[model samples]
Target: MTQYTQKVNETTLKMPVALLQVGMFVCRLDRPWLGTPFLMQGFLIDNRETLQSVRALCSHVFVDPNKSLIQLRSPRERRRSRRETPEPPTLSPTVDRDMARLGLREVLPTYTRTLKGVKQALREVGRGHPLNPERLAGQVDECINALIDNIPAMTWLSRVKSHDDYTYEHAMHVSLLCMVFGIHCGWPRHEVRQAGLAGLLFDLGKLRIPKALLGKPTPLAETEWQLFREHPKWTRYLLEKSGFEQDVVMACYYHHERPDGRGYPVRKLGTQVPLAARLIHILDAFDAMISYRPYAQQRTVYEAIRVLYHGRNSQFDAALVDQFIELMGVYPMGTLVELSSGEVAVVIGQNHDARLLPKVAIIRDRNKNPVAEHVVNLKQLRDAEGKARFRVKSMLLDGSYGVYMQEYTRHLVLDASPA
Candidate 1:
């Protein structure tokens, strides 16, 4: 039997290969199979024999306590390997510039087009086409990249508008929201992308359901609700049939499953549900809350956030929920607010200095006239002795002002004067 030293929770354990079980914790081997080495978390350690079995499965294993260091037995071989394979260049500056450019490139047009594509894809699926996973994946990536690069400037709350195509628009919105939530949960870029894809396709199974039922403005009947609950299973089936990977399929199927076992099709609780699924669930609900459905009135972002916070532990992960609140701030981009100064403005950007005092563009005053616009960096400006003079009193929705968010956002970003 080959002896190996494994690190678990910062403590090193010396054991033979045969003693490992499903739940037995193990740090990454000195050499990983692929990509970044990951520490195993919460796996099932069924029996000692299982541990030995895993050892048999691998030909060679090396132990390393440090996650970043690779231990090569032969210094000569290591030197040769390093000479042949140089490390990839660092990407911080490049990534930052790329992200900024992506944000500024007029993505709304592309977003509108992608929305149409999603609707079209759904229609094709409804008509029994093979549920084109490749096409759907491409669309998912596009939507995610767009949203991540542009999370609405801190000031433009009312301007964050939904498109006319409800189905596709809803998909894009959910994808964006899920991306934000995933970032809050400290998910890596790949996981965040997966979460976005999952959110975009979370309701893909709805294509299999009857259009009449899906479009019903009335409350679902008991039987209809049962059918609705089975959508996740249908989603899993579709994903499997389309050859989607397991992680992607699980995320798509389990986004509706609550953490407390009250969710449908699986009733999985706590860690039973994948992290990707849980992240998507929180974001999916957030998007739905801000959305105006055919039968339900839209909730303001603040109100929607409150609902999410209230559902912590029961419906969502509490830490993730808190992080999400911090990520979006109390007043997110595109939110309209009434300031204490008797002025109405749209939140445009977050002030790096004081999160509470975001930059705003005044759109109306006490008399409610369309006036000359100027950017107000709330962090820099203050009252008499340098105290905050303005405070947000209320958040308003686009419908309340008889404006569409998409149009309003364009005007705000393009026409508003810089402060």
Candidate 2:
């Protein structure tokens, strides 16, 4: 191959603003550059604001570089440039609507406790202890049951993140995402649990990699990259050693594989990838994109969904991506947003019966004042004339307009309590 072609393949990819890190050269935006903060055509990302500024502008951008100093890697793109329209943020008419949204309050306990169990098991695996595959399976069961009962709570918990516990928490979140997806697709309980187990075990192989490489704050060297992809074999060995089902082991082995055969390890294309692996791959990418990692920036829920949408067919299963968009809707729960009414809010819950009009905590007034927060369910909300109560003007940066979901949720509970 010519050097230029190699450089282009090695360099440019469509990346969400959240994953962009300091020192990477951002060569393009999702929109025009005329109104942006940058003066030059391409500039090094210097600080946190660079990402906040970029996210405020567009969902994705062209990041052109052979490498990065932050050791950050680009998410695989489904299309090559020329942004396509995002799928209309709508729900599938065929879905059960209340697939996992049933009996939420009663099932909340099972969902909350399973995360702690999974975290402890993963920590043991990191220390080279044997994985209790059965224990993991049980947690997967709990996870699936929890989602099967109360999707909004499980989904909301998934969005609550911690930078220090990223690996463990990511595994837990991905597991929840997979279970939710399975339930959404009308999969049987056994199938849903299997998918959840696979998500929990997706990164078992990475535990074998050296901490220096895994924890590197800067862009990794070519050698480190080589070392990174070899963890699949290690993961397989660990899973087998721990007596996980063969299907579960294979899922972890191929979660990084893509539909076009462009992914790592086996590089199997299309249906050659296991179905469990395919489901895990999409949610894994979704969680990684939305969550903060020391190595990469975090994208908004919209940006992450859009990247996944554009990647369909070429980089991911087109049908699965569509289902994911349909599932998460235009705004997933916990998303901080600016409404057309000029109110600042955080999505707190989702309507299960129909549509993706999520419930939001209105934290700031249209005039941008800190308001006494109250919840609004978008689906039922109607103006005097009876239109959709409000629309999201644009997805906002998480902490912008002084709205943080965790803090807002805490106060919400307290304020609702009787004196």
Candidate 3:
């Protein structure tokens, strides 16, 4: 409504953050796009929160006058000139209920296809075939779509399944987490696709490294370590040659670099590392910690979460780490947990508001015997006193009390009905 005039000769105009309005289009910021929470290359200022977010991160931004809904005019004249834009429709309760009832089997096909595509691409890279950018992009897009359809189902499957080969499994895991993180942060679709691609390609260079060195049980000597560190550089070269975009290349190349500048390769400090790279770094580390690598012992979900929480700001971006923890919940999916009632359960979904309370599938009864699987929404259940009916007494290891995720994952596949 504030009347302001600026030269319209240029396509982009740099204006102070104070002049930014809700309807403006922010084409570029004063700082790098990846350094801030705004992951999209460009975005429309849709609401007051978005406007404030931009203002908080930047002093000035490059705006495109053509993209904005309003032009220079007095408040009264502007109100009369422009038609009010309708707000986007919110999901109706019926739609929400349907999505809630959507079976995990409904999403598994897409998830499997995406994972298979990732494995095939990584295998091609291992065999010295030239990377296909178009194919990789398509794979990433499918992955993004699957996550959009049902994030909890995809996430649960990703955590439950593991490949015989670590390289292939790790690539898919990191890529899935990257896509999930992007969506959780409310990034635009383009940025989410880019993040997914970066995750898939981030560790392709490891294929070029010798298997002996990678699978070595003991600590690597300095020479081996130095050679191991060249994976990022190799990734950059491979992507550059494959004609991938510079942003994706940079993300894969610098994922090992850390916020505190203590990370490997170039040792980029703080925002010097791109947001996608910083995001991939967290996922890569978390996956690695919980995974069964030859050199390291597999850690429980709670242990991995602790490592990420403690390393915040020093080894990783503090805010991103917090968000990652929040996304995964205190008891992440696929985790084996013992409830207060002496039953064992596997975490299936997160309750965002209640970090400790999560939706789970009870697999074992109080006597540690196998039982019929039933989902318990911990957030919904309450005792007469209104306290949580069944609290997670303790986190269990992968194969606790004769119950294993691998077995229940099979059960889930066969009985694919909605819980």
* Every model's TM-score: 0.69, 0.70, 0.73
lDDT of 1 by residue, 104-223 (tens): 344665566666777787777777776666776776677556556555531122135554556666676777677666665667877877776777777888877887888788999999
Question: Candidate 2: deviation at residue 213, Å?
Answer: 1.8
User: Which TM-score value belongs to model 2?
Assistant: 0.70
Which ranges of candidate 3 are over 4 A from the true structure?
Answer: 1-102, 417-419
Ranking by TM-score: 3, 2, 1
Encode model 2's per-residue lDDT on 1-419: one tens digit a residue. 11011123556766655445667778777777787778887777777667667756766677776544555333323233214645333333112123222333345467557767877876887788888877777778867766765777678767767556788788888888888888989998877877888888888888789988997989989999999999988989988999988888899999889988899897899888888898788999988988777787788888888899889977888888898888877778767888889998777666543245666767789999998656666765655533566777778765677666556544444443446
Worst 10 residues of 1 by lDDT: 64-73
Top candidate by lDDT:
3
**Model 3, 272-329: lDDT tens per residue?**
8999999999999988887777689888888988999999989989999999988887
Kindly indicate the candidate among 1 and 2 with the higher lDDT: 2
Q: What CA RMSD would you report for each candidate? A: 16.8, 19.7, 14.2
lDDT of each model, Cα atoms only?
A: 0.65, 0.73, 0.79
Residue 337, model 1, lDDT:
78
Q: Record all residue pairs in model 3 with backbone atoms less than 3 Å apart, i.e. clashing.
A: none
**lDDT, candidate 3, residue 272?**
89
